[model samples]
Target: MTDLNALEDWAGPLLRKIEPAGRAKLARTLAQQLRKGQQERIKAQRNADGTLYTARRPHKLRDKKGRVKAKAKMFQKLRTASYLKAQGDAKGLAVGFTGRIARIARVHQYGLRDRIAARGPSAQYEARELLGFTVEDQEALKDLVLAHLDL
Candidate 1:
């Protein structure tokens, strides 16, 4: 994950220039934009660095013909705006998974070893950067800030 401290430093001056109400609005806008980008990337199954996510483990169940069943796309519901959220206030903004889903997201985000199911075997999931500051996001942040200032 990109260090947010750096972003805070870079954005500090520009954000300070805005009035409280405008800053709050800008924060909401930024959060929404970032959330949209993240949803797109997750749908594409790409990491923050633009690399393809490690494929999901193959299903164990087989068809009558003995072929393994094709796995469904990963994180379909999890990536939706309901499970994932974008919220902001005067202080700052955040785009992330909310509720219990966050625990599942964290498992994949850090490649942690966890149980596959209750009483099932544990496995190490590969790290998939579910969230991070990408290069494009950095540029977009700059553009958004400049545009907001212009308004």
Candidate 2:
């Protein structure tokens, strides 16, 4: 299980000052902000390290006649499949993507190897760090938390 407690040191004091309902609202808002940051990073093809994702492998876009055809970028489907859901309760709020495509994100994020097709050999993809925390993300989170507390 992911430990959200690590964030307590940062937002705990502010969270404690709010009522239960307000805390839930703040958590939901924070979750949305985090989701937006991740989506932006993926769209920009950048990892948490600020490095560009590996150039997409070229696709075979030629027919037998050597005519060029358009091709989609690698992970295009996965990127478009991104989503964020916030779950709030009296205890706190949890936000995450709940879909099969999230598995693909985890694979790429960790550079894990898996088979592309049945009977095919496993292939390893580069680590993309799609959902990692960045410096900008920290600043954004802080600003968002403060703003929400103000309301």
Candidate 3:
């Protein structure tokens, strides 16, 4: 599990010491980095464990013999809708999809079962680390925080 509290603890003091504008800037930087990470995951279609995301369940567009009639890119809408929001107070950032896309992403991220009218009952998907912080990300966040601190 992600130690988000630990990250908050590490950032709290530094954020408190900076001016509000600086703090917001730092927060935006963090959000940008997080957004980049998420975009990379979508492009790679692999989880943090280096495993490719399970092939998307086949669709119902099949011909007479039960062969697929058409192919569609998986998660295309979800990928396109991914976004980032840096809190104005500089206390937090959100990196994920919004609206309907948000619901779909959560379902996939946790491998939760859901109903798809076109596809029938959905299978449990493999849990994918959609917004995990890598060691490199942590180091970079630390550096960004330190750079904004008064020391």
Q: Which of the numbered candidates is closest to the native, going by highest lDDT?
A: 1
Model 1 residue runs over 4 Å out of place are 1-3, 64-70
Q: In candidate 2, what residue range of length 10 has the lowest lDDT sum?
A: 77-86
Give per-residue CA lDDT, model 3, range 24-46, as digits (tens).
78788877776676667767886
lDDT of 2 by residue, 67-103 (tens): 8888654555454424545566547756555676677
Task: Please count the clashing residue pairs in each candidate, in the order shown.
Answer: 0, 0, 0
Q: Which of candidates 1 and 2 reaches a greater TM-score? A: 1
lDDT of each: 0.87, 0.71, 0.67
Error of 3 at 49 (Å): 3.9
Off by over 4 Å in 3: 58-73, 81-88, 118-123
Estimate the overall C-alpha local distance difference test score of candidate 3. Answer: 0.67
| Order of candidate numbers by TM-score, starting with the best | 1, 2, 3
